[model samples]
Target: MESISITPTIINPKRVFKKTTGEEWYNYYAGFSDDFVSEILNSFELPKDSVILDPWNGGGTTTLNCALAGYNVIGIDLNPVMNIVAKSKFCNTDDVLMALDIVKYLRVNNYPNKLNDESDFLLNWFDYNTASYIRYISFSLQNKCNTILNSKVFSLIFLALFKLVRKYIGKFIPSNPTWVKKAKNSNDKISIESTKIKIDLKNILREKLSATFVDNVSSIGKERFYCASSTKLPLKEHSVDAVITSPPYCTRIDYGIATSPELAVLLGNHPAEIDNIRRTLTGRTTIDKSFLEIESLGLTAKKMLLEIFNHQSHASVSYYYKNFAQYFIDINESLKQIKKVLKRNGYFACVVQDSHYKEIYCDLALIFTEMAEENGLSLIHRQDFMSKFVMANINSKVKKYRDKITANETVLIFQAN
Candidate 1:
């Protein structure tokens, strides 16, 4: 099938990932599709030496697409789990098989790899045996075998562990798939049969991870992803040729809580570890006690903030107003960082949606345009597609706040001045 040369009419803006394979490693509640990234790359007809950057590299959709297209890509995310996941894309059969050989060894020997990382978070969310098995697999994957398994191989194994853990912790995940709750009911014993899981794990990892994606590593510019914050970027000044990223929306989504299960299963099992990450992210729910008054957030943000402050809805002034203020603050700082890294005349495309604080409209697209311009990014093009499905539409109670069934997903294209 021939690829769409022209950027398609925006549907959900974030996926239909089935169009591309191997990206189904993790289900992201807030990630754009590979098809969308392909269109952006094609439509822009970027320079041959162009280096792509996905600042908010949720689930590796942008980074993976860039790799397939043979562009040098860098994917960054604050969540450590995402870095492990993004790197998994770089793995081939050799890398995956090596990790599997280690797994085979561990299983055959019955490695008593206990979950010495006594985790209250896991205890509240998962059955002891289930969590222990997951921890054991993760620890084994992280082991130093013959000068330490290559980053790609370890990441592939870690991704496999995530797949296994997701099946056993079904009871904790709520209506919103991202939101994982604590303390399963005693009646609801979601126990994993160790024998069945071993079979499932082998089948899942072997079939998925062994398949090759990138045809030639030498032919293409390499992809590098890191567990880094977007606000404080790791790239050098004027290093990036283009930035293709969808910054977190101002909807106050807790990105940290969304990936709590992955964080608990692999990196850190403490709730504070999760909360600390949440506090650092751009669109996270937590608030700072000594919040800085941001003057550079632009006129559009100020007006929206004022409207939310005066709104009559419950908690509109106290909680909702403050939440949006912090988002704009972080976003303002991020735009500045983006401008610093983008080469002159380079392209920057951002996908954003409008939200509501009760009846007050938070025109995020307009706000972002203003903020980007303030940071030396000149607006070149803009397209708004009415999104049939949005996060707000999922909640029945949202109808009371606004009768509108859908939101507009605006793609703002800009050039670095």
Candidate 2:
């Protein structure tokens, strides 16, 4: 049969609701449609119990859909919180009731404790009483690990608090655009009110519990999620039948910092661990400027990096150069690991978006194809779909490096050579 090129018509974003209970729990910043994943997986003529792999499972869309389709799936992500979130979606009805019971217990017995020493991120983003309540909740959840709900159930509560804090605080001040915590001006400090802080945490917690405990939800198959880097996949050779995932963008959107508030709630005591995880993510903004060594880059990626390095005239030119070089290098390393795990003739599909640095367009799909070919994978098909407005500052009037950047989502499929 002749090779076919899948088009945008094959994808329908509204199909995310097809698995309402599974998809509803976790909505990370970078996520794709569940239908998109289903279409790609269905294209291949694989057995029902094939083992599928998702290296960069941002919001667990690939893993969730695969489980619902009755395939065994392994999802790996560097984000600790997301690892639990992905695994939690596969929880049974008994697990949901257990999570609800835990939430109820915490609500009635736990009292807001005075937070004497909290992280600055928490202090700035949450008001005093809000921070205290979060501390209280975290304290209470930690104490009841043996009986009520396992660590995973505790994560559900932590994630709920994480969502509620951001929801209410966002009403006060918009999230900082950059990764670093910039010095807030005087007027920004005055906007947070104590009454706003007192927004019923119990009510929000119960609502989250209700949403998680759907009427009739069942796990399709055995699914596992691991907190591991994509560059170093810990799987046996030729083990997985198919690999499907969406790698992070090279546009310097700090995945760690974007989810830092959640991390703050989860790992408030472990500041060093938080920083280490941030530094280890694929396209983190804080690159080591002194370390200028570029990894194994394909011809297309090298050309793009050099062009961006030469053309970039922004204030943070050095940082941009490092970020571009590091992203491709990391991706190339990850592709090699992916090839090691995929069986002969196994399919590899990636959902990526094109990005812009200054005026230069980073054709991520083309660059990724080059990397895949270098690592002995043959391109089978490419599909382009109109993505939502997730680009950086596309609508803003500011003339930043990432402003006015736009592109469609491209799915590049490859088969093992």
Candidate 3:
């Protein structure tokens, strides 16, 4: 139970979480780094059966790494798409291979030749031919639902199709599922040959199947994931040994839009449902202003929000202020839930980035530490380092104000008492 040393160096997942093939379950954006998780876990003295809980288990980074390290884990997230990811990553090698086999067969043998989808979301992003191809795969998968049910094959199929469509077809253009702005091919400026380069679905599937094979999949720990909100985790009090997670960024990166293509395939047949789902996620704005008690936000956070609100000359300032306020409130509620489930003296570590709200710095790590302490956990350690990803994200927002952005993160560890 010695504290781990921290260097000023930033933690990068690409460098830290290296494994054999088949580790890339989902091409998710902004997941916790496996190396960061492993570094923290190694510093803790724990039993082999210690239960690790990651309530915001995006892409299953924490669960997958810890399971490989032989700890049992319970990961929870409100997004069903991410739930599918964590669950699929932990599936046994046989089941994963089985899923790949079934999906491959269905995709190739029973391909539907026509598009039946009238969803504007799908239509706007995909050309007619691409749409038809995607629809055929969806139809074939739906027809084989019984065979794919309770297995990871459905998720694998969805993920492979997601990559094929997003990388090859969608061209990484839409900011969110809402696609409020009309969609245009960014590649139009390039050349017809580059944009129209043929993509072989069968070849892509074959490559995906090969990449999805896990050799030491049997060593993965006993794990479970829930598509439940973190504010109301479905676990008993004092049940978990440790909590390792990184909550969604305060930056306005829409999770709904980030995974819209996957959702379109998995949940949405209509384009309107995409916006409906976006509104339910924690980070989005709230139109109702009646419930905001800005005064209740801690002094540190309240100062940051007021600065953003006061500095803004636009009518939309209130909207941004309210969204920022709601984000902190939501985080506080989640902290209470984490405290409730963690055993006394158990550790809770979060990787959080400090972000800007209209050019005013929001010391998110300090705010989260204060909030966690208010909810019955005490801060044990704090480490800071610069992250290029954070700087790039902030710069995207800062370019509007013509301000320079510097980004750094803090690793806050707290003990439940």
Which candidate do you rate higher for lDDT, 1 or 3?
1
Give each model a TM-score: 0.90, 0.83, 0.83
> How well does candidate 1 score on lDDT at residue 403?
90
Global lDDT scores for all candidate models: 0.75, 0.70, 0.68
lDDT of 3 at 202: 41
Highest TM-score: give the candidate number.
Answer: 1
Model 3 lDDT vs. the true structure? 0.68
Candidate 2's C-alpha runs over 4 A off are 1-9, 12-23, 107-120, 146-152, 172-219, 289-295, 315-317, 388-390, 395-405
Q: Local error of candidate 2 at 292, Å?
A: 4.5
Cα displacement (Å) at residue 401, model 1: 2.4
Q: Give the Cα error of residue 61 in candidate 1, in Å.
A: 1.7
User: How do these models rank on lDDT, best leading?
Assistant: 1, 2, 3
Determine the C-alpha RMSD for candidate 1 after optimal superposition of all C-alphas: 4.1
lDDT of 2 by residue, 1-417 (tens): 123443322474322444444335755656678778888788875788799999998768888888788899999999877776776665555555566676665543247563547553465555555556666666677666642223556666666666666665554434443343522643343233334333454454455544553234454756777788999998999999999888887778777777776776766656678898889998887786455555467777877778877773764356677788888888998999999999888888888888776667788888999889989889987878765555465436335544344467887889887
Worst 10-residue lDDT window for candidate 2 reads 1-10
In candidate 2, residue 219 scores what lDDT? 44
